[model samples]
Target: MGTFQIEGGHSLQGDIRPQGAKNEALQILCAVLLTPEEVVIENIPDIRDVNKLIGILGNLGVKVKKLAAGKYSFQSDDLDLDYLESELFKQEGSSLRGSIMIVGPLLARFGKGYIPRPGGDKIGRRRLDTHFEGFIKLGADFRYNREERFYGVEAPNGLRGTYMLLDQASVTGTANIVMAAVMAKGTTTIYNAACEPYLQQLCKMLNRMGANISGIGSNLLVIEGVESLGGCNHRVLPDMIEIGSWIGLAAMTRSSITIKDVSWDDLGLIPDTFRKLGIQLERRGDDIFIPSMESYEIQSDMDGSILTISDAPWPGFTPDLLSIVLVVCTQARGSVLIHQKMFESRLFFVDKLIDMGAKIILCDPHRATVIGHDFHSQLKATTMVSPDIRAGISLLIAALSAKGTSAIHNIEQIDRGYERIDERLRAIGAKIERID
Candidate 1:
């Protein structure tokens, strides 16, 4: 496992740019398999999970080329279908949760898609029922091998579009079904679909590739099936979760930081959500400017109730950044309740913050109450193990704002999301070094 050694209690300066949306890149990469022509994608994040999916694509005989940094072209004119059933594919597909997305496009075009159970963060029980259910609704035969944890979808007669009301507004699930529906024989309508900016970007990209999709920014998507799709150039939006993390980092470390080209309109409720915690963030054009804050207070709810911050679907606060917000609140001037309704085990990392002298009550697996120290009592740095991608970044933020130097082990989790985060932090005058 790799480690990060960080010296805390030092403020940062200079500007940073958020990487391309990781979530968007995952969906977009999978979308490339839908067409035979060249599809160019820009602003792809250089993170582990994204790269893993790209590697899987390459292994499947897709012509992959790197035009430049954060730019690539993929042409899936010919694919090695046998690789899908090979042991190598089983291992590779099982290693990445994002790999599940490839199934939809493959099933749409190739009439069959098979994959082993995908692996990801151990935050909670994330089931694949939604994806399979959507496929079944589209007239695909779904089969599972429980002992091997393998899933397969096949439609030898070709997929026929149909209406599907998803059980949940799952981002990946929505992307998968949309990809499958595009090449189906008829119209497909999806309700309760996830309408996050990333999903919207995917929809727009598919449209550019010749799929007729409506309701770009809403939960109800109407897709008219087309026989085939051509390739088009697509650029991913800036990652909103990373932007939120940086905003929280600036507030906690009392740093003056500028995040450039953030695509503010696509960020939904992220900026305003931070403002509820009394963090002063301003929009200078497309960039976000967070000034050095000695102390920021949590805003109470109207009618004099305690403030509550929770995650919801698009236009709602994102669950991915809740970990960052939770860490930031440890140093704010007031109290807030963090209700992580999406995942049961996400808030468990608060125990490490409690170890660092932050006042937090782990109300349950789903909720926590935090009383900010308001910088009066800075955290005492200590050794910590990164639990997952979001939690690791949250812990890193807490470590950077603490009193002494701290060591974080298993930093591979952080790398799974952030792109060369140590180098980026060093550029912003942060005292961070990576150790293998």
Candidate 2:
């Protein structure tokens, strides 16, 4: 295991570019399977989970080439269908949650998709019901092997488009259903779909490759079946979650950091959510400039009640960012309640913060009340293990803002999402070193 030894209270000052969107990359990379043509994608983040998916594709006989840094082309000309039943495939497919998305494109093109239990952050009950139910609605056979703990979907008769009203706005489920419906025989309408920038980008990319899809930025999507798809070049948007993390880090350590080429329009409700905690940031054309501040205070409601920050679907605060918001609020001027509705286990990481002298009340698995220290009291260094991706980054931000040095083990969780985080943060004058 590796650990990050971070010396806190250092003011980071530099221009740091956010890596490409990890969530979108997961979705977009899987979309390459919908066609046999060469789909060239740029700005692909080099991270563990992503690389694992790419390896899985290579094992499946997809020609993945690295054209340049963060640029690659994939051609699924000779997919190895039997490989899906191999033990190697099961071992690899179980390591990343993104593997679940490949099922859609496989079932759409090859009439079958198989996956071992997908592995990802243990934040909450991330069910595969929405995905399987959507596929069943679109004329696929779904089955689960209890002993092997595997999922399979097949449509020997071929997929036929149909209407599906999702139980909730599931990002992966929406992407899966879209990929499957693109090759269906008739029209497909998906209501209450996830309309995040990630899904929008997927739809746009598919359309470029000859899939007829409409309503890119809304909950409802309409897809007209296409015979086949060709390759297209796609560049993913900036990682909004990473951008939000940078914003929180800047506020916690009172640093001046400029994030370049951030797709501001795609960052729905992210900037304004940070502003709620009194973080001052300005947009310089396409860049976001967070200046060193003397003080930042949290904003309350109009009725003077303590503000409540909660996560919702698109155009609302993202659940992935609530961890960062909770960490940043620890140093704010007022108290706020954080409701992480999507995931039950995410808020449990705040106990590490409480150990470091922050005043936090863990109301339940989903809610927490944080009374800010407002820079009057500083977090003391402590040792902790990273639990998940978002929570891991949150702890890193807290460690950087603490008074002494903190050691965070299980940094592999952080590495799964953020690319070379310690190295990148060190470039921005942060005193963080990766130790094995």
Candidate 3:
């Protein structure tokens, strides 16, 4: 239970680099299991969830070596398939949501894959039906142990590719299915697949590993099954969610922060989405420069309607940054409606911000209306407990812009996403300290 004691009302300066994408790292790391050759990956973020996945891979007998900082080589020449049935494996696999993805690679490379029901943030009901259903469609036998709360998929007769139209555009589901289909007998087509940059990165990496995949940036993906896949080198993209968080932080604290090497091209709808909130940010080469300001104004629609920001699949705003968007609107000049379509519990964190004197109305589990203070009133710092990763970072941003010092406990949630956040913040002149 780590705590962050932050002194508020100070503007930050200097440049901060965004970490490698956590989501991409999870998918790419699992792809290493598909081939027996050495797969080298760079720009891996040092975070709790990612480290946990790597540890799980090591337990399953993948050869992992840290070549240098933020770079590693993984070889899956010999895997301990028996480990998947162990109690120790069950305990480890059940703790991470990313563990669900490993099942797909294992099922494709070997005859079967078994895993305990995966766990992660208590955001909402994230079912595994999509992943398993896709496997069953590809001629795999599926079984579930309700008493043990476990899932298993086996294709002892081998997998054959087929077309699948997903129930929903679930990111992990699409990644899982693609990995399974990459080595199937025939061609596989996926419609309504998630085309987020991270997912695209996974598909492109699979292509580099000798998997035939097309439609790189579109919802429709075509995969031609190959007999075997070879290892390849890949570098994960900069985390767009962290980049958005820093943008929000700079606005809330009136800081002039430059986020370097942000991969501006891949940040679809992120920059323009923040621009709708009237935040002034400039693109200088590959860097994003957010200037210090006393206040920013939220822009209404052309027809004089209140601005409504909602999350959707790729081209739309990312659900991960919606928490930061809600927080940034707290001090804006006008009001905005935040509609979080994916997770029901994400908007629940607004009550904590309200306690800090920000005016917010929680309409329901999925919707909230925020009336900005326009910097007329500063947030009153107080002690709080972090609920999840995105909400924790949003609360930290609020604390940084508040009138007094605030304590944020259970910062491990924040650590699961952001890498060395406190140290990075310190380098940028933020008044933050960690208390163990």
Candidate 4:
């Protein structure tokens, strides 16, 4: 296992370019399966999750060629659907939550799809009910095998579009259904759909491939099914998750950092959430400049009550960034309630924060009340093992802001999403080193 040894209390100052969105890249990669022609994808992040998904595509006989750095051409004309049942496929597919999206396209094109229980951050009960429900609405039959822990779906009559409302605005769930509906036989109306930038990109790509879709950036999406999809080139948007992490990192260490090429429009509710903690940010065109602040305070409600920041579906504060926000709030001057409504185990990471000398009360698995120390009483750094991608980054931010040296183990977890994080942070004046 590798670990990052970081000496804290250093202010990061530099212009760092954001990597491509990991979430968007994964869905777009899988969307390539809907066409047999070569689809060129650019600005893809070189991260563990994206690499693993590419491996999965290769196992399925998709011809994946890297033409240049951060650019890939995928042609699935010879893709073998039988590999979906292979042991290697099952093992790799179970490692990522995004793998569940393959089901929609595989079933739509090949008439059947098989996947083991998809694995991802153990934040909470990320249910597949919404996915299965969407498939069933599109005329697919699902069967779950408890003993093998695999889920299979088939649509004998092909997918026929139908009106459906998602139980919740699950990001992956919405992507899955959108992929399926694009090739259905009739008009598909999806209500309460996830309208995140990632989903918008997926819709735009599908539309470029001749799939008729309307309401690209709203909760209501209408798709007129196309018989087939053609290939097209797509460039991914900048990673907002990385932007949020960097914002938190700068705030915790009182650093002045500039994030370049960030999609300011796609960063819905993110800047506002950071503003709640009094982190001053200035937007110069597409770049975000986080100025070093002498003091940061949690903005309370109009009635003078402690502010509550929680996660909801799309266009709301993303649940993925809750861990980072929780860590950032620790260095703020006041108290804030962090409600991680979507995930049960996400807020449990606060114990590590508490150990770092921050005052935090874990109300339950879903909520925590954090009282900031404003870095007046610096946390003495120690060894910590990362748990998940978001939590891993959160711990890294905490370690960077703490005093003394901290050894962060399981850095691979962080690498699953963020690309060359140590290198990026080092360029920005952070004192961090990766050691095996």
Candidate 5:
């Protein structure tokens, strides 16, 4: 495990660019398995999860060529199907949540897919039922081995597209099903699909690759089966979760920072959510300028109720940003309720914040009421273990804004999502050092 030694109380200033979308890269990397042609992807974030997926792809015999920094071309023409059943695959696939996405494209192209129970941050119960159910709806045979903890999807006669109404707006599940349905025999209509920018990017990229897909930014998607897909160049949008984190960091540390090339139009409700907490930010062209804040207060509702910040499906406040918001609220002028709806265990990390002298009431596993410290009482730095990716970044932001130097252990959790976070933060005048 790695640790981050962060010295707090210093303001950060500079232009920082958000990395390519992590969620989008997970889906897009898996989509490369759909076609045998060269799919050139730009702005691929070199994070642990993404790198793990790319390594898995290379191990499965996909020709992965590095075009440049943040750019790569993948060709699946020489895929090794037998590799999927190997012990190496079983072990490696179990370590990555994105491994489940490979099942859909593999079942679509190779008529079979096998995956060990996928693993990611232990935020909550991440069910794969949606992915399996979608495959079954598309005429794929689904089987799970309880003892081995492995899932297999196979369609010997090839997949046939059909209507699917998802149980929930699951991002990965939607991406997997969409990838499978694209090459199926007929038209597939997916209702209640996740319409996040990640999915929209996937749809656009597939369209560019000759897959017929409509409904770019809505909950309903229509995909017409295509005979084959060709190569296409795709550039991922900026990471909105990271953008939200940066916004929170600036507010907490009273920094003046500009997030450049943020793909502002695709950010959805992210900026407004931070603004709800009275964050001062401006959109200059595609960049977000977060001015150094002296003191900002959380806005109460129009009816004079305590402000409540909650997560919802896309076009609503993203669940991922709720952690950043929760951390930022600890430094705001007023109190706010943070409700994390999607994950049961995400808010458990608030205990660490409470330990740091922030006034927080853990109402439940999903809700917390935070009374802002407002710099009148800054958090005292302490040691902490990173629980998950989002929570880790949240804690890091908190640490940077605290009064003393704090050490965060298990920083691998943070690295899984954010690419070289310490280096990037250091470049922007953050006093952070990575300790091995």
Candidate 6:
């Protein structure tokens, strides 16, 4: 394991070009299994999750080639279904939640699929019932082994499209069913679908591959199944999560940083969410520029009441950024409630923030009330280990703005999402060093 020793109280000042979206890249990579032709993906982030997904593909007999830095070419002409039963496949496949998406394409093309229980940040009970419900609705027979903790599905007659409404707006569930529906026999109408930017990109890419899909940016998606899809080159969009992390880092360190290659149009409600905490960001052409301000104050309601920033489905504040928002709220001038509705355990990391001298109240498993410091008193640095990706970045931001040195262990978790995070922060004048 590696650790980041950061000398805090340094302002970050430089230009950062955001990498490709890890979420989008993983889905697109799995979509390669929908066809046997070569698909080239550009701007793929060199992160651990991406690499792990690529390994899964290769182990399943898909040909994945790294054509260039942040570029990959994948061809799944000879997919080996038996690989899914291997121990190596089971172990690595369950390591990330994104791995569950592979079940859709595998079932679509091969008429059957098996996946072990998917693992990710232990935030809450992330049930696969929605995904299984979608699969069964599409003509798949599902079964589970309690002892083995493995899920299996068989579509002997192939999948036929149907109209279905998801119980909730599950992002990965939406992506999984969408991929399955693209190759079904008839039409699939998905209501209450997740229409996040990553899903939009997936839909656009499927369209480019000859699948017919409508309602690209709305909750309702209509997909007309096709016999097969062709290969096409698609460029993943810039990482919005990284953009939010950088925004928090800049605000916490009182730094001026310009994040280039940001897709302002795809940033739905992110800027407004930051603005709620009085972090003003300006858009220059396509980039988001955060300037150094003397202090940031939380925006109150018209009745002079404290505002709550909460997460919902798409077009709402993203749950992934709530940790970063909590860290940013610590530097703001007033109090704000950071409600992480999607994940029950995500707010558990606020105790670490409290250890750093931030006033936080963990009201429940899903909510935290943060009282900002306004930089009136400096936060004391302390050694901590990263629990998950978002929490890791949040702790790093808090460390960067603290009064002394802090050591962050388990950096591998941070590297799973953010690409070359330490190097990137160093470029922006952050005094962070990596030690093995």
Q: lDDT: which candidate is best?
A: 3
Which stretch of 10 consecutive residues in model 4 shows the poorest summed lDDT? 346-355
Q: What is candidate 6's CA lDDT for residue 334? A: 96
Q: For residues 207-245, write the lDDT of model 4, one tens digit per residue.
A: 998899999999999999989999999999999999999
**What is the lDDT for 233 in model 6?**
97
Q: Write the per-residue lDDT of candidate 3 for residues 251-356, one digit (tens) a residue.
A: 9999999999999999999999999999999999999999998889999999999999999999889999999999999999999999999998988888899999
Global lDDT scores for all candidate models: 0.94, 0.94, 0.95, 0.91, 0.94, 0.92
Per-residue lDDT of 309 in model 1: 95
lDDT of 1 by residue, 224-256 (tens): 999899999999999998999899999999999
For model 2, the superposed segments whose C-alpha errors exceed 4 Å read none
Give the distance in Å from residue 178's predicted Cα in candidate 2 to where it truly belongs.
0.2
lDDT of 6 by residue, 288-352 (tens): 99999879999988898888999989898889999999999887899998888888989888889
The positional error of residue 13 in candidate 4, measured at the CA in angstroms, is 0.9
Q: What is the TM-score of each candidate against the true structure?
A: 0.99, 0.99, 0.99, 0.98, 0.99, 0.99
Q: What residue pairs clash in candidate 5, if any at all?
A: none
Off by over 4 Å in 4: none
- Poorest 10 consecutive residues of model 5 by lDDT? 267-276
- Cα lDDT for residue 215, candidate 3: 92
Candidate achieving higher TM-score, 1 or 6: 1
Inter-residue clash pairs, candidate 6: none
Model 3 lDDT vs. the true structure?
Answer: 0.95
Candidate 4 collision pairs: none
Give residue 169's error in model 6 in angstroms: 0.9
lDDT of 3 at 58: 99
